[model samples]
Target: MAYVVFVGGLVVVLAGLTWFASWAKRRGRGSGVAGALAAYEEAYRTTAHQSHHELRQQADRKSESGSPDDL
Candidate 1:
């Protein structure tokens, strides 16, 4: 049980690190230890991708159209 707990903790830590890296990448934070990963993610997002920016733009347009549900 103790071993299992230790492994679980390690996995959780690693997953958190990955999530932080991804979050940093999306925010375009490319000037620290994770710069390379951030740049790679940015490139991927810009090439044949449909996330973040696209969805935000769509939502903005919808709001501009004055949709009642959005208000």
Candidate 2:
């Protein structure tokens, strides 16, 4: 009997948490779980960062070349 009550209480707590998460998401606020996961990936993952300087250099070269028909 005690075990059954414990399990029921656990289920109610979990359901309440699920409802709160859905409400928060609808309000345009996250639980910060995504940001935490992103930070973890950035810390451990390679190729996660972009080279802005390299991108700018490529854009400059393309502009200088005008068009392919110029060649």
Best by TM-score: 2
User: lDDT score of model 1?
Assistant: 0.70
The local lDDT score (0 to 100) that residue 54 gets in candidate 1 is 62
lDDT of each: 0.70, 0.70
**Residue-by-residue lDDT tens digits, candidate 2, 9-66:** 9999999999998998899677377566556656776344234334545867844456
How well is each residue in 1-71 modelled by candidate 1, as lDDT tens digits? 99999999999999999999899889977456544544666787654234545654686784437668887
Give me the displacement of residue 21 in model 1, in angstroms.
0.4
